[model samples]
Target chain A: MATVEELKLRIRELENELIKSKQKQSDAEHHLRPKIDKMSAEVVDSNPYSRLMALKRMGIVQDYELLLFDYDKVELANMNRLFFQPHQAGLSKVEAAEHTLRNINPDVAFETHNYNITTMDNFTHFMNRISHGGLEEGKPVDLVLSCVDNFEARMAINTACNELGQIWMESGVSENAVSGHIQLIIPGETACFACAPPLVVAANIDEKTLKRDGVCAASLPTTMGVVAGLLVQNVLKYLLGFGTVSYYLGYNAMQDFFPSMAMKANPQCDDRHCRRQQDEYKKKEVERPKQEVVQEEEEVVHEDNEWGIELVSEVSEAELQDASGPVPDLPEGITVAYTIPEKDGASGETVEETDQSLEELMAQMRKM
Target chain B: MATVEELKLRIRELENELIKSKQKQSDAEHHLRPKIDKMSAEVVDSNPYSRLMALKRMGIVQDYELLLFDYDKVELANMNRLFFQPHQAGLSKVEAAEHTLRNINPDVAFETHNYNITTMDNFTHFMNRISHGGLEEGKPVDLVLSCVDNFEARMAINTACNELGQIWMESGVSENAVSGHIQLIIPGETACFACAPPLVVAANIDEKTLKRDGVCAASLPTTMGVVAGLLVQNVLKYLLGFGTVSYYLGYNAMQDFFPSMAMKANPQCDDRHCRRQQDEYKKKEVERPKQEVVQEEEEVVHEDNEWGIELVSEVSEAELQDASGPVPDLPEGITVAYTIPEKDGASGETVEETDQSLEELMAQMRKM
Candidate 1:
């Protein structure tokens, strides 16, 4: 047996170890474990994904799912507009977004990738990887949203999406950060990013050279939040097929001015892929089938039918049997009931009828 | 002393207790601790408040501060547009906002209050509490932002602000959740919330009653974020006096339309306080001082300022003293360099001849 003093020392050591272990576990609970396992519409405080999952409950989405980027580290500024926790400060932007969204609706499958989109190889690889799932089998992505800041990244995303024939939406905020714009590109259908040179490119100025040394551009959570909301709203509209999707929308927050316009594909486009896609679109349109309207005559038409019912042809015995046997499928709540002989007259009928056949039948019955 | 078995049992108990303690510590670190002591502009992943604090570095806000609510639990649904952590679920909405904002910008002074705004007594008490600090030395609240979802709450806030002669802004989203609006209200200078009843309230339908038993009004984080951003933006503009603060702006996300309009306060307004405010505004306008334009004639006007040397006024002794003794401010890069001329010629004569006389004396000297 050990001495009592030795036992006390052992106990103290165990207590210290226990405290560290408990701290670690608590940290894990706070930062690691997801809060929810699935989307719920309980409208309770515990439901983190309530608003997003509400889309499905509200009949806006058939099955709502999210695919977001996992590359950029979320800046402290992004916290104002996005659901990023302070403990997640050092995490990648995509990871932070995923972590936040997972807690909201853990059922939402997330795919994250980190890479500089400005490079051609990286852009192409990313596009191909998403378009054709690499390691695991997955469906092609429906829409590509470019929320990049610089012009180079925008060009790369635009180029990659154009090459893959993917539908993509581009979002950007002005340097002053008070204004923002969102544009939808349908490859061969709408204006490609390359179709018309960007404003800076049009002026033949290198966008990269415009940045002055030691000066950072201003950004606001409000501007970014608004832009992100607009982008997501457009995504829902496109996927759920509800409202009209804006082709090009610009927001000037200072003046609360929103300007919208549609842009046609440029005939003198620089990109070969865009030009090729436009040609294919034109060719497909020419070969597309035209639809024709056809009219047919039926057994009976209510007099209230537009233009009044016209008799095109005589009804056959089979057609008459089909119509009368099924009660002619009269409008809702209009039923025809026959009266029994014991009844003096048809009980439910309010109309006065003059029928010679009925009078003759009654006379024969009287003679019998 | 103690038995060996007892010591073993004690050790086991310590281990279990250690685990629990560690878990709690971890939870506190993740959910409770304020991440920042002061807002810093250091652009690093670890600094969560860097971006928000950068607003000061960017010269937008003089001293960035925040005032938020401290009551009502945050639901999962709010995660769509806000920085809500799952750990913050049980915390009141105001507390969650405070916690999150505190982590983002610990330097921002926070004043919190909890109360039902719809009740007149509660509103008055809360307003008084904030206006006259109950916990700390009193400082008047600058502007009140009415972000309440219902009409009664909006009316109460408007009334309170109007009574205090406070400037306030109101924000709301539509039932469909795809549209939103923000308006600025200057108690006496602009339309109060009650000056013209909101469209929903004017219809005499209770918004709460419109919600079905098992269904909630659909909400989108995007819509909320956009609205929040616009609201904050208007607040910043009102506070910092940089951009045009929108008086009434409405956003139609479906059509990507933003409509703006202005309305004057109704002369026959229902709110007695509003009517009183309008009258005070009229009285103040009458007593306001008028501005007058005063032009000084001491400075010599340059002849080439227009028409390239058309005669304007003769050069005076005072003008000569002002020009030679003190530097005459030139438009851009034309510096005045006087010549001593080896003490043989007048030093400032070249500029003098152009003006005309010591008119002829100046002209001869200028020619020399």
Candidate 2:
């Protein structure tokens, strides 16, 4: 019934209204969550860092800072894992991660590297950053975390960390997506990635040959989330100097089995840098002071016993000795009920003994 | 300098350009990620569900559907954990979660409940939904997961599930933000939440009394993420019937210890519904068909050996017998080296023995 001119005007007005509404929505979102310049432990709904800062209050960690590095762009397929959103597709992974992490905790300064670390030029830059990138310039970073997918990238990190005598952690999820592992690598103290290559590489099999056309590795948010959680937990433990930091931790989702073991650095490691690090570590060990033993003083909770009552142990010393060998010294009121038998062989020695001569192992792998 | 009238006109034009650019940005974002109607395991960059559906291709899960329920709104403080965004602040958590999850997998249908399930009126509705909220109406859901933060909500879920004989998984993180646990609750089969209330509840202490003014419980993304990962992994295993489903799994981040154990249902559970479910389970157990044991047949890899060589184990029968007792039947070419001693007591019996009489435990707790 309306004229074409009038109808055209109405449509244009509707379009303008839609745009205005969209703008208002965006503005409202921004207004609701204003950029915070400082981290506060104040428990409030608006304080994004309150929960995180509570760790300090609870004496879990003294402090935490985050840095990100990646050369890949976010893809829709990555949605199966955590973090990135649909709208983030095509954005550089580092930039996207930084944006999300910044919104979560703006107080922490973030530096992102979007270049590949495998390149010779980038490797130099990476090394330079590791040496100088800290709260205080010229001081090396407290730790490095390697979450790269490929063995090549892992080897590059191993080389850099070994050369710098830096401590780092390596993490990975298996191609099947049901298993993952995180390992702490202290350059000279622990085995570097190169010390024992993965079977795929050690066997002299082309990694590419494992993949087929039109097929890609499966990934699940559950596996990645668990791995990331464990990695961060390990990082917190190492940095805060609390808990026994694991040398190697593995997760198998299928059986819900977590296997952990410590691996000593290989003296015959192929990497020359690793060998140099081992030498330096041996020299430093000699220079280090021996730990002083401190005697623990017992505290008297009740200086006066008005009731004149004393507590007695339920089990006799003879019975206790029968349960195990001579009991170790214990606190006044504490007594041991039982002692678990020692395992057959020391875990560390078993692992070491399992390895054949490096050349022989390599030869066997090559034949496979 | 421009005249006032000309300057005002120029300012208006610049404002128009700004709005136009914002509109364009919004349009581009929407265009880049079009809504997908079905899940596809095509291994392409544009398919959000490709990696998830690959779980099916890899035979991990037949299918996975998600449903969300929450009465709380998203707060900025939640940013410390995974999921949710800054702009999602003030939005209902279920709605926000639904939006995010929908974007990740559009093929799955989602239903969100925004009301508290503890309310009497809502509890009935909740139960009703649970009874008929399957892909096919009038059937129950495959599983229910409880990620609630409070004991009251957990009790509500437990009551509902017990009444319906529905199986569910319960997950929680400790207040200190360093430990967590997940339990699989099969009504009448495993211990229901009410069967043994938490120590605080059993001691008749008001849970609220444990909290201090101005000090909220601490939380960590790591703990929550790990708990969630374990929970969802359990869910997948239970649904897909691959790995053994853990009855109870506890995670202590400080020690990186994962303690697993199974608990039997308490005969004197407080909940009447639980008792009824127990009786029903007992009746069903008797009615269930006995398992059929199928003997495994060995496959002949080399039917024809031209060399006519006979394979013999290196260890003799006497040596093998010395290592352990009589060896169990094994396939040809398999030999036993050493056998691990079985742990002392049945794990289930040990847990049961550790628990004092419920009344005695309760009385002791109350005295504390």
Candidate 3:
């Protein structure tokens, strides 16, 4: 048998060989791929942004830009989903995401923030960025997307958006990892996060108290991936103005059920900023110009018909308008579900009015 | 001013420095992530598979294993989507996927096939592997997932699965990249791909003729990611026996619509193997034991009530059975939609039977 010292020396030699082989492999990979300075739509194997640029060619989007924010570092647990790699465990999530995204599409400019948005200083900076961070400086951003997990982070976003009168979308996956949802928040036009607090918050319970030591919430890659995909798809639709942007969409994996509904903002919302935004939105609605309706002459399919058969539309104009027209303040396909009830019975408005309207809509849907 | 020769020398030196810096960065990354020998369920920052393994503890999946199949090499264009990286451009897709998947969860065993399955020789090999490639040797795989893009490859999988009586799921994205669908096939029990050929195939058009030179199909990362998410979610549900497995689910991103339906196997399928499997399934169904129903006594809630008021169920037993009972040869939630029309009009069966049932189901859905 070899001596312990000899064995130790042999182990060191093997370790050096392994390291050398790894270096060789890394060098080969680096040599194979060179960074491109611009995004190209060329139909070639080497154009990374070919498919994405095709979206612009197809007239699905005007232009796309990217920005990232995160207060946490990348962890190995994030690998179960997508994006982060095992080698990036010690890097900040925003830095890691920016690096990977830059490599994928170098044409897009990136700005990453690695601070907690809930903090007073960061929240002010976040609001400033949202107000004047467009492609053209001093202009507000087109939209905001919230993918934060905790209630506090969501509330922080809600408060900022409400104060700024910004449109945003929020997404979340259930703790059990079997369901998820994405909701659009149009400041005063739709229900903000503060307008309808979750049951835990409404009950005045500390959200932190729900956590237990040595126990973690369950998660799955499939649910998170689906939620992310849906959220991005919605973002594309809203930006491109090509599809019906959903107000609220939910997914239930257990039964493959998807429940969608729109909720109206509460008139008596607790947040003063939300109430102020609602008043401004109402003022804007009064000043908005009415759309003009144009009528087209009906085409005569058969100029000379022996039978003289006449064709008429089965759908009436009022019904057609109902199907396609925007509601009083909301967009088409978005109907008010209900408003949050006021606490302390301060407002004695009959709940029956909202309840009856929701029932009527559900009844109509059932009769469809 | 420097001479041309001196400038060239300076450029060469900078290039050398660039290469050295990249090498150092790669080495640091490699050292940070050591290969894990086993998957752990402990929720920690370092456990990559912690979230995935939680499924077992949550009683969703009993156990999971992975196998991959692909013939194409990775291209930079694929980086717009998830999974593949820029460094993996020249690598075979199956090999790259196996490398990434292995790093995510080292406990799972993987076997990758990197050849076209449509060829006669390779088809035989593929069938053989599917028949005896389970964790337990000599047994078939639990399920086969077909993510192939071409009609020829899909048909190849359809044929093999039909001949072997294996279960599989087929997924696809639309050519325009705005829609996608997932369909589950249980050999003879459901509609095989050959049983209902697409319109182009039914018209006997050469699929290759549809392609044009210097033009490529449109694709979006969001649509593809969503399709993949749905496909994997369905796979998890099928393998884990947790959720209701859908027979056919369609997604239209333009309208955010998800249309689901089920189709029964055709009696006059083009593939002879499918007919044989159908016969085998029918015989097996006859041989299978029927489940015995257990009746429970209703508990009295108002035992001491002098008013003699008693509560009764509003839903009848027949309605309950209709809602939950499995169809004769299909699972619950799977209803026969329509059969493919016979080319020669050999079968005298009326198309109205299938059409009326589908209409009734639609009517019921509208009423809900």
Candidate 4:
């Protein structure tokens, strides 16, 4: 048996060796990884291949089998006011939206329309009819989706969605129904105009662009393409759950923000849209929303008899208590809030309390 | 121009109409995505971009940066047990390591051999000597890194690493010099195994090969290669802090015997080899009679919150009430433990209890 002293000595020797070894790998990866990303872009810009790298780099990408549908010719959809026919009279956005519709694939598809007269009640009736049609035809429909443009039409989007989401959650497909309602709703998901995050899109604000476009400024092609593209991206990844999708994405004309959003895993902001819809949804029965059905991904941090993640405030406090020396780990149950406040207008939205607890905030959404 | 209620109505209409549209998008994604992925894989496999894309996709084909520091190169390092060489040596792993090394645009590359032998005394002495060398040579090294394996190393052959991870984070390099009797170790910005979760590599039992090579059961190159690959991946990524380095990837392998073994991350587990012999330096370390680190990549669930990456049974019943749910995010004073049973023969790894209130758990990680 070697002495403890010898073991210590040898371990030291290895440490130095390991450090030097790292230098070489470091250089290669530093230069190469970025190049890989660039190459991926190159492929996207020019190559025929289109599947991008996995979002999280978690290795395997197992796709969940989904209930695919098609409604290209039958269920075509677009807001006539915005439709641009680049390929038609001149490729317009609505045209692009149509193109997106035509090209999208899966065995089953739904047909939307070119004409519209509006009201949440009118839309709800139409949806109830079509949904019944699909159910009557004995077709399996797991989700209902819509992709639209900036600020102008998303409230109606949410209202129509709230009823559908509620029905999907409550009345459900009486016989065989899907469990959740995915918004692919873009702006609605990003929060209200005031609640938009700076990261999502950097809008260029010249006095001209600002005065001319105001909140409804013209969106750029690449940015708009990303929005439409992300719509496709979101739709493909979220429902069957083969890939991961971040909660929100935004494009700002004033702040010059486009695709400038970040991922907020499980946020608890009682924003106007979320709050308003929840209240609208729950007139009869309002119970605590099922926050968690199961504790899926959690680890118990038990350091120094403390439990959980390191709080930003407690490091020094705990260190002071243990003079014996090096603090091992941080305390648990501490998480930082990452809600970037959106554009809450002056005297505009409902109770904007900064001090709402998570439960309170969640309760607000549940009211819908 | 639409009225607010009209806008809301339109929003509701759009929302309702968009529902099926969104589902169509989802279904389309399912059908088209796989084809796109297949096409993309074909492009990568064919390697279209001549040098750039090929270099990006294939990833410096076999280049091991650690190869440059030969035995005689690093003064303080133990030449005998170099960090790692490809098992089938005289083969190109060294050339691979070296080729990747030469391309780097680093300001300087300091080569060394066998630097990461883990031990207290040796760590102390070498640190002192290096500091002295820097003072005398008039060239100071800013960081002292002990880079171990990345995610690739912890991957098992065909089935395992799909979820199980690889990588070890023990003593991180910080500006603060952590010193003890014989170990005056200073950590730099580089995150130690303590910061990132420890990579757990387990011996995979090859049933097919077991029947053929019978008794010679453990020949899992794919698994070992996965661990080795991810190790290099992290080493490279860590050196250049441009990308994300996941905090945890866990594994707890299922054994064929009455009892099962766990290959997991622990705050205290360092990647000092379990010891054996080879060259001159190996004489002192190798003859030292080692403790077995682990031989199989078992099953492990990694938790990303501040709570511990792996779970443990150390917390009692009263503790379980708080422990059962997701542990809080780790605070500075807490140590998270994977709540599982002890392994085959390992014993007495001290755990620090967390002091987070149960309320935090029920709200966050616990979500119960």
**lDDT (CA) for every model shown?**
0.58, 0.67, 0.65, 0.26
Task: Identify the candidate with maximal DockQ.
Answer: 2
For model 2, the superposed segments whose C-alpha errors exceed 4 Å read A1-22, A32-38, A57-65, A292-368, B1-22, B28-38, B57-65, B289-368
- After TM-score superposition, the amount by which residue A25's alpha carbon in candidate 2 deviates from its true location, in angstroms, is 5.8
Count backbone clashes in candidate 4: 150
Q: Give per-residue CA lDDT, model 1, range A238-269, as digits (tens).
A: 66554557776777665555655445565556
Of the two candidates 1 and 2, the one with more favorable lDDT, higher being better, is: 2
Displacement of residue A153 (Cα, Å) in model 2 is: 0.5
Compute each candidate's TM-score over C-alphas: 0.70, 0.77, 0.74, 0.25
For every prediction, compared with the true complex, DockQ reads: 0.13, 0.22, 0.18, 0.01
lDDT of 3 by residue, B181-245 (tens): 89888887777888766544444556677665545566778888888889998887766555556
Candidate 4, residues B306-338: lDDT per residue as tens digits?
A: 211112122334444443344443221121211
Per-model TM-score of chain B: 0.66, 0.73, 0.71, 0.26
DockQ of 3: 0.18
Weakest lDDT window of 10 consecutive positions for candidate 4 chain A? A169-178
**TM-score of candidate 3 to 2 decimals:** 0.74
lDDT of 2 by residue, A1-368 (tens): 55555545554665676567667656634644555555677878887766766566334333445667789999988877758877788899999898777765555578899999989999999998888886676888899999988777888889999999889999998766777889888877667887766544444455556556666666777888899999988886676555556677778776566756555577877789999998998787666554521111001011121211111212333543532454233211121222222344532111222224434433322332
Inter-residue clash pairs, candidate 2: none
What is candidate 4's TM-score for chain A? 0.36
TM-score of candidate 2 to 2 decimals: 0.77
lDDT of 3 by residue, A1-368 (tens): 54555545554565565556557656535634555565566877777666666555334343456667789998887877767877778899999998787666555678889999999999999999899887777888888999987878889999999999899999988666777889889887667887666544444556677655445566778888888998998887777555556777777766555655565576667789888988987787666564411111011011111221111112233533442342243221121111122233232211111212323332333332
Q: Which window of 10 residues has the lowest lDDT sum in candidate 1 chain B?
A: B293-302
Alpha-carbon error at A169 in model 2, in Å?
0.4
- The candidate 1 chain A region of ten consecutive residues with least summed lDDT is A293-302
